[model samples]
Target chain A: MQYGFFQVLRQVELAPEHFVIWGRLTPPPHQPILPGSFLHLKVDPPGDYRMLWRPYSFLDYQPDTHQAAIYYRVVGEGTGQLCQRREGELLPAIYPLGTPFTHEGVSRAIMVAGGVGVAPLLMLYDRMRHSSPQLRVEFLFGARSGRDLVPGLLEEFGVVARMASEDGTLGHRGYITDLLPEVLEQGEWQMVYACGPNPMLSALADLLPEGLPCQVSLELPMACAIGVCNGCNLPLRSDGGRYPRRLCVEGPVMDLREVDFAALV
Target chain B: MGGSSAAQTAEGFSLEVSLGPLRLSSPLIGASGCVAFGEEYRRLYENSRQAMEGSSIAQLGAIVTKAVSLKPRGGNPPPRVAETPAGLLNSIGLQNPGLDHFLAELAPRLSQLGTKVIVNLVGDTAQEFAELASILSQKTDFPAFELDLSCPNVEEGGRSFAMSLPSLREVISRVRQVTDRFLIAKLAPNVCDIGEFAQAAVEAGADALTVANTWIGMVVDVERRTSRIGRTTGGVSGPAIRPLTMALVHRVRQAVRVPILASGGAVRTQDVLEYLIVGASAVQIGTGLWIDPMCPLKINRGLREYLARHRMSLGELIGSFQAEVSRGG
Candidate 1:
């Protein structure tokens, strides 16, 4: 439940504001880090102002090396401080919390990401390849500009990457939602997994075809990253009503149909 | 401390605690609101088998459902909760499936649990509380009710009734007319003197008391220069609020004769013991269950081990450590 020595093994600057850091954990020998699950790190130089733990989803995992990476955006003081840390420094973490993405009985999958929301999707990509190579995967990445995209990461996984930027500097000029119509028409995606800004997710929810399976990863200010805090809750539409369901316990990855996007915001 | 004492008869392990007419199987009960209507964690109860199975109905010592209202409420805006130091802040805006829906949907689910569900009722007015209690009492499945007097009076422009004794007493008295089911009044931490409110609720026929709910707190988004929670202010719960909960529980226990169910910061067996020593009949694990799903099982096991080691039954320890207040020690 609690991990003490999961230090940052390597840090790669993906963009000006976004950075990818690989944390090499000394997990109890036989234990393996699964994709979609996250780690809660105790912020060093603890003070009254910044005492709570920070959570980051596992972006990629290498079981042979015992290293896991997280993609984080410098959004707050805690993340800004985390971004500044160099390699070899020790950071205490509580890991692999919550349920992971279900990879069984899937022949093809489509992954959608926006900004730092791409983190979990990348992990899913790797895990699917290793777990079931027959699983065909494609990724659609949306960012503000072409510079924000993580160059050939999707291509390395043999995934067809579709780039969309807000500005006309990349593939599609408008939102990721603009391309959804065309993507659905081209291929039969068995399952659709998306993680991005709320607006993009809402748009996708509306555009999604019926009977096709879809799941989304949401972001919330997490304290314990475990279920107790009740900090992360996403409203789910059930039987024509909405209820605030705990995201950490019930799900961090929920079926799209079950989620009430209108109730969430 | 004889190994085969005649006093330790064939009941296995039993402790009788009273909450008005209702006699609990043991002093250990789940806190209201923390555990859902008992049906929510049915899978967990099934998984743990019967060792961890507390009565879904009366298993909680008494069940406290999440805050309910007269009509269905949609609750607050997005980003309803955020993490705090040793705590969590939530602006759930009291999102409930409405009284009618609960009566129809949730009541059946709760009834199947085989435990008395203590509906944690909340409203903006005394009339509303009375109406809710009246409707709940009429239902065949409904067993007991706990008026959440601590809810911030949004209708009165955001003033909590639990902060004032007279206001809380009036609500309890109004609900008493409709329901003979045991009434437990839950208190709020946003008050100067909780003893005043506790005495008033007891006088107004409240059978028991839930020590406290979340305290008002806020987290700021420095970049946007705005609060992180959708509703700028929220109730703070978890380990950060445990010590304060203990103080209130201890004070209320001294002030009133009604049984007190200690909530707030109970995450471990030691914390539960601390509350019990201070005169709490049972302790509720709130935020602790969020961290470790098996916390209640762990705490229950630990308490059993503690009681066995002390060579004392739970009844012998209840309110046995009270300290009389004198001019000096």
Candidate 2:
């Protein structure tokens, strides 16, 4: 459950404000890093007493390289400190927490991401590449401007990418859902996976064609990525009505149908 | 040397104690109302198969259910929990599926756990407590019941049953009539002296005691100029309160002869050791489980290793320090 910090082997600034760091975890011999699981990073700065730990989902897990990547925005003090971590620094972490995305029975899929939500999708795209080469995948990434879109990474996965931004610097001048209907009409997709802002997810749930299986990854403030805290609870839709479900355990990725979006939003 | 080595040396002389009729494999039971009802982390349990192979609810001393009541509670509103120095402040308002649903839904699931399920029952009045206890006693699988007379957030005379001997005795006596099952009265730390309450419960036919629920606390939002928690007050827990909890446990142990299950502020194996040494028959890990779901298993492993290293068994260690106290060593 606890992992010793591997070195911050590389760091890249994807945008003017965004950054991604790759840490090679010293996985206690025989531990294999998976695609969608995350790691809780111990980013307590020396002599600076504030927050305890921050969790970031894994972007890429290159087991051969013993490297894992995490993409983050400079949101607060914790992220700011994490961004400042230099190469060769040991960032103690708890890895591969929570269930990974289930990619089965689907031939073609569409991934919808808003801002930093694209991190986990990148790993999923890589894992599915060889197994389903002919799988048609469309990635719709939304941001404020073209500069916000992560360059070269999506294309390297051989995914057809569409960009949407509020300022019109990207492919479309509106939200990601503005182009979803057109894309779905054109492609014969079986499933859709999305991770983004609450509004974006709400819009997708409202507008998406019914009967298409959709899974969503929800982000909640978590002290422990594990289920014990019961901090991150989302209302789940059952046959009768909604009930509080643990996001950390029941899922970080759940079938969109099981979520009571109305209650959550 | 680290505390683990010291713990190893001390574990050799633990003892086997009984909390009423329920016997334990080891006295280190997961704290009631801390860990959820069942195993919530299937993946982590599945991944660490070796560590979790034999130990779970089935192997543990006992598993206590979260506080249940006759009526369903919505609980408090958000900012329910906030991090303190080395502790956490929470005012969950005892949100639980009502007693009927609990028996129908949760009881069936819990029956599969293979461990003794000590139901932590809370109520507004003595009548309600007796009624619920009566209903619970009728169930064939119900093992024991803990009267949570110390939940701080309830508006109807908050923790009044715990502060006074008369009310505490009346509540325990009323419930004891309906069920011959083990009755443990959980106490609150906010009181002036917890030993008085422990003595009262023991006199009322209570089998054991769970020392201390969270100490009431509050935090302010500077800009909003209001309390952080919706209820304006919350219960504080975690490592920060270990010293206070240990003192309370020791005091209660001296006053009462019944077994005490030490809770509140337990985060590490050493903390567990400290409780056992100070006359606690068992220890429960609470806030630590929130930081790491696999923490209980880790603590269990660590405790076993500590005992093994010192060539001692857990039963030989309980109340071993009490002798030192009596002799003034």
The best candidate by TM-score is: 2
Regions more than 4 Å wrong, model 1: A1-110, A119-138, A142-193, A199-215, A221-265, B1-16, B48-62, B114-116, B141-143, B153-155, B322-329
**Per-residue lDDT over A1-265 for candidate 1, one digit per residue giving the tens place of the 0 to 100 score:** 3333567777887667778788787543234566667777655542222245677788877777878877887777678778877788776565566677787877688888997788788888877877786877767889888777766555545556788999968888878778777778777789998888877888888988898888888776665465533456676777354444667766778888888787666
Task: For each candidate in the order shown, give its overall lDDT on alpha carbons.
Answer: 0.71, 0.73
Clashing residue pairs for model 2: B12-B312, B13-B316, B13-B317, B14-B315, B14-B316, B14-B317, B15-B315, B15-B316, B15-B317
| Residue range B224-326, candidate 2, lDDT tens digits | 8977666688888888888998999999989998988998776567778888878888776667555444455556666777777767666667776744445
DockQ of 1: 0.18
lDDT of 2 at A116: 85
Docking band of candidate 1 = incorrect
Q: Tens digit of lDDT per residue, candidate 1, span B96-193?
A: 76888887788878767644456788888899999988888886545567788886424354587788777888999988887888888889877888
- Report the C-alpha lDDT of model 2 over A1-265, residue by residue, as the tens digit: 5434547887888776688888887644245555556777766553232344677877877777777888898887668878888888876566667666877766599999888888888778777776686767888999877777867666655666788998998789989889899988887889998888877888898878888888788776566566655555666667233235656556678887777666553
Per-residue lDDT value at B232 in model 1: 88
**Candidate 2: true interface contacts recovered:** 0.09
